[model samples]
Target: MDLGFSQATAVIVGGGRGMGFATARCLAEDGARVALMGRSPDVLEQAAAALVEFGSPDAVGVVVDTADVGQVEAAFAEVGERWNDGLNVLINTVGPDAVGGFEDLTDEQWLAAVDGGVMGMVRCVRAALPLLRRAEWARIVNFSAHSTQRQSEILPAYTAAKAMVNSVSKNLSLSLAKDEILVNVVSPGSIASEALVGWADSVGVDGSDPYRLMEAIDEHFGHPAHLPRAGLPEEIAPVAAFLASRRNSYMTGANVNVDGGSVFT
Candidate 1:
């Protein structure tokens, strides 16, 4: 169960909060050197500080909007400067959800969903390529959604974008196989993130009570899993952490679903 992350260096995109922060924390606690990259400087700092307290004192937070090419390049440049040799892991976990249906969704909304879901991961992988190539071992874990596999009419654009992410990630796994870099996608179900918690609160549901909030999710979004409750961000993080770890040697081009039996493969 060591997972071989003791000396690993990781860059977690959107590592400021929720599942991103949870994964970063797992790695940090396991003795990995972690760098958190996110849009908000404050959130990144707080997350990094928390990871530092978790025993990754060298943990740093770099601010960058994944949507901006220049910002991503700059942020990775800083990462390269800080950890000159290479990068052991790259985790992208910032895909946004677009709630409108096909006919009701605007062009701008579709564009944003694609940008956030697919292009963001593409940009980070581009920026991290050189560093990954230099590493003795490398792994890439990209977060997608279960909606792509199960099909959801409510989030067509979001699901489409995630589908693209899954396809592109599989291609990347094959492309990077020559370098022995394992690349995989993690498709999670209705995770109780801050936004979901806020939605539950808006509907007068207690987000802290997992069963109640999950019932609310089933009633409102119709996204209930077979486990009878929503999954926690912490629950989803460990799966991604394993994929990003050196222990995951043969798993590539696979979409690991950490959903609570939402989609049967």
Candidate 2:
């Protein structure tokens, strides 16, 4: 399927590893020029190099901590300088996953999660709006969690923050519809990522194999999703790529769930 992404300029926040990196590769493979922005220069460079192997050698990396507005603005400026004038796709994936029960969380923890997850997306979307509006067609894909609707017991801060993301996406979709810039959220079930592994380790279940813990959690949680197994980063990437492409013309203000039917709305 041609996604109509060739020659498109994309900016992927937190594109160093896990789902962000996977999405970067997917966009690059579809012939988009991607600028990978993350906190770690080393990791971002490595991801960029790998993308070059699969897509455009011109794929670039920028070190930017999304938590800091100054850094994010500077990174977007760098992207503009490197890739023509503006971006066609802006995918905000820079936040950390929150764990722990409500009582277990500290004030600092809750604030950090809100700042990183909610405020970070706000800053990215605000900064990228000018560039996105420059394109005839643009997209902003915000990463959210299925746990928000599922009412997962733990991760109160994360869940609340993600819910805000969904709200923000819907609001922005309506505001940006006139500009032809589609904004939407993608909520995924437990995808195999480093964040999930870290959450498992923090729960005192230590082992070299994290998938076991993932499976155990899914089983205990009733595995409501139709798919038997957890999703892969690759599996989630294509949906994001399609959303960001000019091909997805009719989807806006919608929270598309790609959780193997885990979220049947």
Candidate 3:
């Protein structure tokens, strides 16, 4: 579990809060130099400071909206100037969750979902490729979702975008293999992040008890994992850290599921 992360350069999109912050914390704790990218300057600043407290020597924050290609490219250009050579890891956690049912989704909503879920990751990866290729050890970890595997009627745009992510990740693994850049995907089940917790509370479901929370989720969203609980951001973070580290050699073109046994495929 050392992850061999000492002095590695990591850039995390959406690293301001939630699972993104959780994963960046894990990397920082293992001695990675993390650059957190997000829209909110305050959140990014707080996260970078916390990463330093967690053990990162050079944790920095950059403001960027993944929806905008210009912003994403500019952010990476700044990171390139800072690092001066290469990026060891690129982790993207910016994506849209299910908003409404198919009947409820407007053209604009669907477009937004694809922009956030698929193109967001694509933009980051495209910008980071040069740095990654120059790296001594490079890893790309893209976030997908368990819903992509099990299927959710209410999550059409989100699921479709994640499926595209999965497909694109596999292709990148193959294409980037020659450069020795490891490209993989992490598909998590429903995790107890801030948004999920707020949604649960809004729906009158208490997540205090794991089993009961899962039961309520089953009744509400029909998303009950075999483990019978929502996953924690901490639980998903370490797996991502491993994937984004020097220790993960020979694993590529794979979608690793951390969905509490919800996805058999």
Candidate 4:
């Protein structure tokens, strides 16, 4: 299916690895000119090099910590100056998981969660709005968690921050509708990725041997979803690509759950 993304310019914040890299690959494969932004130059270079091999030879990597507003603005400006193309899509795949019960979370932890998850999206969208408005079609897909709907435990700060993301996306959708720039949210459940693995480690779970731990987690929580297994980064990427494309013209302000029906009940 042609997504009408050829020649489109996409800025994927946190596009170094995991779901971010997967989404970047999907978009570029469909012919979008992609700029990968993240904190690590090496990882971003690797991701951009892979994209170059796939199709987008002009794909560039910029080191930008999403948690910092100034860095995000600079990265967007660099993309604008280099590409001389309007921003067609902005995907925020920044993962800021603070593992701990409410009592265990320090003020610093909570603030960081809000900054990385909520304010990060806010900053990127604000910076990209002008460029996005220039495009005939523009999209902003914000990464959220299914836990916000399921109300999972032990993620007070994380859930709160994602809730803010959901709200912000919806509000942006309404405000940007007149300009034809779509804003939407995607919530995925238990996608197997480096981010999830690091989250497990932060929570004191041994995922160094991920095969075993993934099996155990699947046995415990996989039953809720109809698929009876965790999702892969690749599986989540196409959904995001569709949302960021012209094909998803009517889906603004919606929170699409790609959770294998985990939250249906």
* Best TM-score among the predictions, by candidate number: 1
Off by over 4 Å in 3: none
Which 10-residue window of candidate 1 scores lowest in summed lDDT? 146-155
Q: Lowest-lDDT window of 10 residues in candidate 2?
A: 205-214
Task: For residues 1-265, write the lDDT of model 3, one tens digit per residue.
Answer: 6899999999999999989999999999999999999999999999999999999998999999998899999999999999976999999998876578999999998888888899999999999998888778899999999888887778888899899999999999999988999998999897887887776777787765556667777887788888868888989999999899899998998899998887776
Which residue ranges in model 1 land beyond 4 Å of their true spot? none
Residue pairs clashing in model 3 are none
Instruction: Give the per-residue lDDT digits (tens) of candidate 2, residues 1-265.
Output: 8898888899898888988989999888888888888878889888999988978558889887788899988988887777665789999876656777899999888988889899999998998888888776799999998888887667688889988889998999999999989998888887767866666567665423645655656754444566655677888898888888889999988888888777678
Of the candidates numbered 1 and 2, which has the greater lDDT value? 1
Task: Estimate the Cα RMSD of every predicted model relative to the unseen true structure.
Answer: 1.0, 2.2, 1.2, 2.6
Please rank every candidate by lDDT, starting with the best. 1, 3, 4, 2
What TM-score does candidate 3 reach?
0.97
Model 1: per-residue Cα lDDT over 134-217, one tens digit each: 988999999999988777678899899999999999999999999999999999998899988998898899987889988998
State the lDDT of candidate 4 residue by residue for 1-265, as single tens digits: 8888898899999888988999999998888899998889999888999998877769999998777789889988998897665889999988677767888999999999999889988999999998998777899999998888876457788889999999999999999999989899889877777866665576666655545445545544342455655678889899999999998888899898987677863
How much is the lDDT of residue 32 in candidate 1? Answer: 94
Task: Report the poorest 10 consecutive residues by lDDT, candidate 4.
Answer: 216-225
Give all candidates' CA lDDT scores: 0.92, 0.82, 0.89, 0.84
Stretches of candidate 2 above 4 Å error? 198-213, 219-224
